[model samples]
Target: MEQQIDSLFNWLDETTSIIEQEENTPYIEALIAASNLLFEQQVPEDLEPNYRTQLTNQVNAIQFSDFEREARQKAMQLAILKGMKGATQQHHYITPETIGVFIGYLITKFVGGQNSYRLFDPASGSGNLLLTILNQQQNMEVDSYGSEVDPTLIRLAFNNTNLQEREIEYFHQDSLKPILLEPVDVIASDLPVGYYPDDDTASSYELKAEEGHSFAHHLFIEQSIKYTKEAGYLFFVVPSFLFESEQKDQLQSYLKEHVHIVGVLELPKSMFQNEKFSRSILILQKKGPQTRDPRKVMLAQLPSFKDVEATNNVITQIDQWFKNDR
Candidate 1:
């Protein structure tokens, strides 16, 4: 579905009278009100009364108090989140369209010949990755699910999907925390990278955490693994350090025993919009305790992000590998 995000912004700009305002709280309040109206209009007419009412109440409860101290920065950051401005990629929220498309194609090929499947994104920012999959797999049927900690971004994601007439199940909760849901067939996400304050403790992520450090990103990966069904595939973007970090040896070992590392696509340094740290896409498949011979993990280096042809060429190679190997 076409994003009418601009229309939402226009409504806020006109009604909030904050077109020239410099304050953050006012803009946030206006945004909350506009978001409610946007979702209200997009909600399906045939939706169950209780479900629709619950959604409407959630929209109504979007208040200034819902945001933390970084309210202004969050508001400004929405531009990048919504693709209104080019993403710098330093934040936990930016999922570029190129990366989204690449992962979408992976999902399509991995689920080849399947008419319908469930797709989940643990850290779905504005539902870009999930929506990209819906666009790519138009001929196939899918039920999209996602969870996010940020209320603003989740609101944007909700409106984006609903506006397109795609009914998605989105949870406004931290993906790093425990969530009980039906296991899905495919799990794909640009996992949130970096450490932050969270309710999930370091002890819970003993597999991926170092002493005195608890990474939300690792917890998200753990959750993704937990939610994926046996034999389901998980496609995630993570820091390159994970591949070689001595601190992550235990976590790597655990992963090796539990799932096959199908492949790792090394991305460009500029892939995160000039972030110096490198990133890679790790594709894994869940397995049972039964022993199986390990297949060669496909490792391919992508060309510079600026070279569109080179990037597409690498994607083609990756697609061929998935097709032939499976």
Candidate 2:
């Protein structure tokens, strides 16, 4: 499974490398189609006619290999990580595997007993959360889906998770909008934080939109929960202000009526370290009337900064909390 995943990333690197050199080539669509073919063995039938032609014109150039692919993919991922300076500009905040894996572990504990499940990330930048979730559930079958507003990151994410037999879907659209698919069992993401132009369509998120300013992270949390099935879980990495500031009260009240606050883990101040952002993980469960309990919540603070062992211990502690509930 790992080798196949590596090969998919290699395809991403190769396609992106080609598109970078041919900036005027309109290769993004073709690259995406080619990747679909490489892993899924077919292009999506809904692709436009022009995109199909563009793909046909470039498909032959995509080479495949059994041995060299893994190393090449790693090189490509590293290159993008180091060279894609615009990643942050595009709101592509990559979650560290350490944190992501811990979240995945908790999510696994919550939903692991099921025979199968669907896990989604509303703002799945670069597909790290979905990939991490898959890593934690090596023995379980999971259908992974995500949506991103940036087309470039969407392509990168689609490329990263397009494993041979894995079910993965990447949508290049705003996650604040409703997804047409059925509600998922688990929704987890490092919610993008910042104020952007208020999306008119997001008027439904009453508390999230005010006058001309809209806080994106709040909206995503609402949207994520909207698509989460009853009793489904949601895990999000959000700015600390969501818990500390006056702005949080409205959303908090809204959540109290809709979902159960599973826990709020305040990360160490150094969690974002050099990034100038303080973050916390907020866990929630979509509740039916019978399951709603506003007081049933846990609050935890991570250990001292730079202590990996202590961090792991905190992760284990949280994992056990969820385990006890099960």
Candidate 3:
């Protein structure tokens, strides 16, 4: 499986390099290569004939149908990670696989018994995290939806899911703006942390800052809560200091009124280069008759992912808390 993933990624890399020779950006090159893999035919029309032939030959050599779902997903993830590294845009970073897998495990614990449910990711960049969760929950039917404002990322997302043969309805617009979507049962996202530039749109959010641009992550929390069903679950990858900024009071007040805190699991500090850039997974449930604040909020610092035994121990503790305490 590892060898297949590496080979598939190598093909993608070679094709992307060929396309890059035509002066396309890294993101576009990846998109083109992935699209060709999905459709089994080259899609770009303006490349030099030799380059087009080379891309087509590379596509012909691989039998994408032979790769397993997880293998294909991992290969595409590597391809996207490469593009992200070359991208100048700060928001292009792909959610790490470890984080995606951990979020999937948590979601499965809560929703695994359901026959079917809807899930949404408002800040779904290239569809990696959303698809990762979906891939992990193959036993249950999931109606997935995603929204993104960046054209390139959205295009890449469409291709990514299409290649995996996963169905998802996507909204290509600013997630903060009003979206025509039905409320979902589960919401998961690696919330983009920063100030939202559109003050006018921020104006409509209850969590909007009293002055100046509002924190985008805060607004995303408000938006996710708004589109969630009664008692639905929300898992967010947020900065460690989410509630320590200048806008903490307002955010805390808003959360207090709208949702029950389920838990906050601080990610391993070793995963990040600096403590200031560290993050945590925040678990919350929308306020409803079926929901109540956990008797004891689940809080713990995760050990480095490299420490397999310690990580599993923490996971076992989390499992027990859900089974016996919460």
Candidate 4:
């Protein structure tokens, strides 16, 4: 599998380099290369004839169908990670595969047995995390949707899912703005953290700041909650200081009114470069006639993922809690 992923990534890198010679940025080159890989044809008519021919020859050498879905996804992830390295934006980070798999496991715990359910990721960057979750739920039917504001990322996302042969409805716009989506059974996001720039849009949110710009992460939480069905679950990768900031009181009040806190699992500290930058997975269930608060909110400090036995033990405990408590 590793070799397969490497081969696919090498092809992407080479193709991207070829496209880069046309004076495009690494990000654009990668997106173009990936799209060409997905369609198994060169889509750019504007490329120099020589570069176009080289890309065509490279594309013809590999059978994309020969790679497993996981291999293809991982290869694309590598290509995107490389592209992001050259990007100027600080928030172009891709979710680590381990974290994506962890979130996918949690989602499966709640909805795996259902016949079908709708899932949405409002901050689905490059569709990596959302696709990771979808890969885990292959046994069941899922209506998946992802919204991303970045044009480059959304195009990469479309190409990624298309190559994986997974169907997802995508919305390209500010997720904090009014979305025309029906409430979903589950909402998951590695919430974008920062102050929202648009005061007009921020004014409409319950978590909007009274004196200044609202925290984008705070507004994302509210927006996600608004698009979640009653009794549905929300899993967010939230900053460690989420409830310790100046606006904690208002955010807490809003959460208390709309949802029941189900769990807060602190991710392994080793996963982050600094303690202050670490995040936790916040689990909440939207209040509904059928929903009740758990006897105790699930809380745990997860061990380093490298400690396989410890990680497995924690997962077992989580499974037992879900089976016997909720």
For candidate 3, what is the lDDT? 0.87
- Please provide TM-scores, in order, for all candidate models, with all chains considered together: 0.74, 0.75, 0.95, 0.96
Using TM-score as the yardstick, the better of models 2 and 4 is: 4
Best by TM-score: 4
Q: What would the per-residue lDDT of candidate 4 be over residues 1-326, giving only the tens digit for each residue? A: 99999998888887777667665666565565655665665456777788777876877788888999999999989888887876767568788888889988998888767989999999998899899988888678989999999888888888889889999999999999999999999998999888899999999888999997889999999999999999999999999899999999999999999999999999999998889899999999999998898887888899999999999999998988887777
Comparison by lDDT, 1 against 3, better one: 3
Better of 3 and 4 by TM-score: 4
Q: In model 1, which runs have C-alpha deviations exceeding 4 angstroms?
A: 1-32, 35-92, 196-200, 206-210, 273-275, 289-294, 305-308
| Candidate 4 clashing pairs, residues 3+ apart or interchain | none
Per-residue lDDT over 1-326 for candidate 3, one digit per residue giving the tens place of the 0 to 100 score: 99989988887777777667665556565555555555555446776788767776877787777888888889888888777776777688889888988899999998867999999999998899999998788679999999999988898888888778899999999999998999999999999999899999999889888888999999999999999999999999999999898989989988999999999999999889899999999999999987888988999899988899999999999988988778
Clash-forming residue pairs, model 1: none
Q: What TM-score does candidate 3 get on C-alpha atoms?
A: 0.95
Which runs in model 4 stand beyond 4 Å of their true positions?
43-46
Better of 2 and 3 by lDDT: 3
Candidate 4, residue 143: CA error in Å?
0.5
Candidate with the larger TM-score of 1 and 2:
2
